[model samples]
Target: MSGRAAGGGERLSYFEGYRAIGAVVVVIFHAYQHNRDPVTWHWPLEGTTWHDLLRATDLVVDLFFVQSAFLLGRPYLRACLDGERRQHARAFLVRRAARVLPLYYTAILLVWAISNPILPGDWPDLLLHVTFTQTFSQAKIFYTNGPAWSLAVEMQFYLLLAVLGALAQRICGRLRHRSARLAVLLLGIAVLAGACDGYRLLAVSAWRLPDTYWPAWFGLPAKLDVFAAGLLLALLAAGGVRLPGAAARRLVGAAGIAVLVGGSVVRLRPGFPETFVHGVYGAGCALVHGASVLGGSHGPRWARVRWLVALGGMSYSLYLWHEPVLRLLDSHGLLPERGTAAGFGFTAVLLLAVSLPVAWLSYHAVERTGQFVARAFDGEGRRREYYRPLPDLPAPPQIRDVTEVLSLRGRLPAGTWPTRD
Candidate 1:
């Protein structure tokens, strides 16, 4: 495959396929988690490879972080490479908040409303969820929506990126070779992230610090390596780096699979340090993402398959709502019992049947509305009045789907930009 230069407004369909895959795996993992007692009681289901694979599916969440970092970092990195100054820090934040908050807050409020008892004691924790601070403490992470702890960690990434993006623009403004400057910046970030992950591993493994999954696993510092992996991939692509041949591509792809599977196996072990395990997992995901894009002339035709794209489109909503839906069904005893294979199959089918449609509706109702509002703030359609293109620099690349921008962003159009000077 010819090397394609990743650009400002291109969609990486291959990554979307991964998104669809990850979202479904997460849903299945959550379902299994909720019904673990009964599911594990069964003989074949308890110790089989199928059961272990389902248990290990939770590792896909880190893949989401890797995807997000690349997609989110692409545009800003492109803008910096293009020599655009005058950062819109305020507008940038508004765009980020607008993209995520509507559905997120709605989920939080829904949990609060339906939750049986909101005691006075729980008020502070509730506030943390509302403020997206739930990841800071172990206790607050699973109070309302169980899956939202990841969202809290992601929000921290967004805020950090927005601020650092602004700073990078200012610092890189005077550098003559923007690509070299970006490379240095990315390297610095990668090193800093590696150090953070190292410290976290030491804290857990050497110091006898608590390795509670919620606080230890969910912290931004613990996950920065994954985000940095994504960032570096994005930066390299924008700088027009490309993998060369079939052999190289295969090597990269195989390495990615090894890291991902190896890390998952390590993660599932009892005494392994989570920080190192997840760091490897995150790096593996980043490698997979980069190899997938760089190795293909166009993304795999399979990525364009209708059902997968549809699933990818609603992945966010599905991720957010599936846990609550499972809890609701479990509470009412509407879901099938998991002790028997037949019952477990029925439960999985029923959950998917019900959850996919609900998630689709939620995407239309909440996620789309949030994107529309965010675009309004970003001056999408109204760019003539509210937006001003800088005099000499290139116009920012136009992305087709707003949701993609919020989630994975767009793909770099092939053959559109020069691969080298």
Candidate 2:
């Protein structure tokens, strides 16, 4: 329950605060999208800049991915840079599975049960969800848990990190300069991401295929740049790389804020490729994240708020459950009518009130339990290695010169000669 878990690195409270904000923004974006029926009605602020900002808040999910990559990648990057080859790739997979699968599977099953009819053909989609390959499958990507496509992307990221970690270990062995090693690692990640982006753009432009069909936007390849940004920041922060003066750092932070705000409010239509837009948005988030790490905070008040910390702690669970819960609300007629200011406002309040408690429960029941199970496995492994049985001891050599000892003592007992008795 503390900032850090057992045997884990220190918690970045600022990132935690950012997660809370990002999660809330996602919830609001979904609320507006689901409730606003453009064909039927219109709210007072529906066409205003405020409404555009609300719609564009979906970009906040990039922030989520950035934070996830930075936080989760930090330890992996540390081990790789330290030239640790015995990182136990299987153990890494098991640990990640334990942390991610429980709630993810639960959400998938719940969505399947609630949304889809019990049909024979639907089983394949369940298999895809279980294996986290739905993002690659045409029929299953948006099947049950609508928002879980990101989880699929993230799963690929995890596997890729393991591969990259090994590569970094090998490369670090050959490189003498720490800076050069870091540069090589960054360049490798950038090239890979850029290659993916280029492929996606080429496919979109040349093939004349719909962008929505297994689109690169939702794929791990397209998202790699965002993750790479986070990884780069973590690497630099960990390596204690040089930075500009304090004033310059503050200016960097300010610029990050500007880009984020500007990107959200201004809409980009279909003409501009999404790859470029997302790259820019992700860059802004990475900049903000790096600046926060360098500057030592994400604004004092937001980072320090008790409720925000709690919300951030439960952000993952909230994200998993809120969309489905909103659908349930809409089906039951609990939510207000669509396309009204009051409707949007009320839906936001109601969803937040309901989703927070559900998220809290899921965190306690699911996420915390998964973490505990993982710790138990780690502890068991350590105990086996650390608490091995001791070796047997040998008896002391017999005293062959007892008679000399008795002569020197000069005060032997009467029972010394047991044979005489």
Candidate 3:
């Protein structure tokens, strides 16, 4: 989602799979947007179930938000609830910037060079984007690259989450019981999420702003509820809550998929309330992620498929470049003819073919390099190291399980608890 591995040398294959699927869905949605004949189907074409469903793919963006929040929030939640050593805010933010900014800035410059004309007022727009404040401005929200608005929202969330984590670290210290601390933190997150949802509703109802208004509906406040859903998942995981059995975990996951599909379908109906749409969608995301977390060492077999995991690794680049690539294809007459099912399918496939290799390159050259650089700045002196396999060497240290570490806390010395930070 943010091109960063999970904290503590762990990976959640299911979440990676989700990113891959969500990224592809978004690319397809964009292809549909640019390739569809305005005269025939038009934007927001109603009474056509399949077309409407394609349009609904826009909501998959929310899943990205949830994934980012859950992955990033989990470690902080563990520190608060389990007394693990917390990552310093400086280190946390620096790593976040490295994960996000490199590809983002490159995308902006490429988009501008390819599409936007240099003008007197363009500098300010570019400046806004460079600062990640583009979402706060109506004109600049989708200025160069449209999908980058979500990146802006993500950047804002990073700052907010860092502050909240610091605050939680302080507040959690005074609480005597872990349960009470967990309860307090959960309540705080819920209340904040509620306030955000209420602001979103007010924008639509009282301010008479359309849900499609970028500045009104796409900013950090409007999407914090979705992130809060992820934060709730992190809290549950940190608190060691699990479903009763594997059967229950599987059932819950199935139900989560049902809810996600059902919510998208319900969202297609005319005049559905904006108030409930996000809440339902976020809930579904949380359920699915929670089930995956509880499902044991390796999640569902499909999640670990080689190609899917690789695609997931490069999803951020795919998301960044797909729209511009789609436009380039259209301008060069490379896209298939518009307005037919066959044409749509061809366009989607063509976009993937052109975009996938570019994404792979970006991941290796930009994302991985940025992460390697970030590791060099680690405050805890954890450097990226390479090792060779040898029969004579002792077995590599196994990645410690968070639950196991927590369980052994009482027996271990206070300063000796196993920690990645």
Q: What are the lDDT figures for the candidates, one per model?
A: 0.72, 0.71, 0.80
lDDT of 3 by residue, 1-421 (tens): 5834455233486667778989999988887777667687554333577776886676678888888888888888988997898857788888888889889989898777666555544777788889999998988898888899999999999999889998998899889999899988899788879988788778867887876677877788888899999899888888888788888888988888888888888876788765467667887888887776765546667877878877888999999989888888888999777766777778889999999989999889888888777877757435544563634533333336777666665665434435543
User: In terms of TM-score, how similar is model 1 to the real structure?
Assistant: 0.82
* Per-residue lDDT of candidate 1, residues 1-421 (tens digit): 0011222223565566677878888877666655555534443267678887776676688788878787777767777777643447677667667767888888888877778464554677779998888887767788889888888888888888888887777767777886667776776677857777787867776776776656766778778888888888888787788899778777887898898889878766887766687778778887877776666545556866768866787788888888888878888989775565566666667778888999899989998897677656543322324566645643345556655455433444433322221
Give the per-residue Cα lDDT of candidate 1 at 166: 77
Q: Which window of 10 residues has the lowest lDDT sum in candidate 1?
A: 1-10
Give candidate 3's error at residue 355 in angstroms.
Answer: 0.4
Q: Which RMSD does model 2 reach against the true structure? A: 6.0
Model 3 Cα displacement at 19 (Å)?
1.0
Which residue pairs in candidate 1 have backbone atoms (N, alpha carbon, C) closer than 3 angstroms, thus clashing?
A: 7-412, 10-410, 10-411, 10-412, 11-411
Q: Determine which window of 10 residues in candidate 3 has minimal summed lDDT.
A: 390-399
Give the clash count for model 3.
0
**Superposition TM-score, candidate 3 onto the true structure:** 0.86
Model 2: per-residue Cα lDDT over 105-172, one tens digit each: 99998888766665664788888888888888877787787778888888888888878776777777
Q: How many residue pairs clash in each candidate at the backbone level?
A: 5, 0, 0
State the displacement of the C-alpha of residue 66, model 3, in Å, after optimal TM-score superposition: 1.1
Cα deviation at 99, candidate 2, in Å, is 1.3
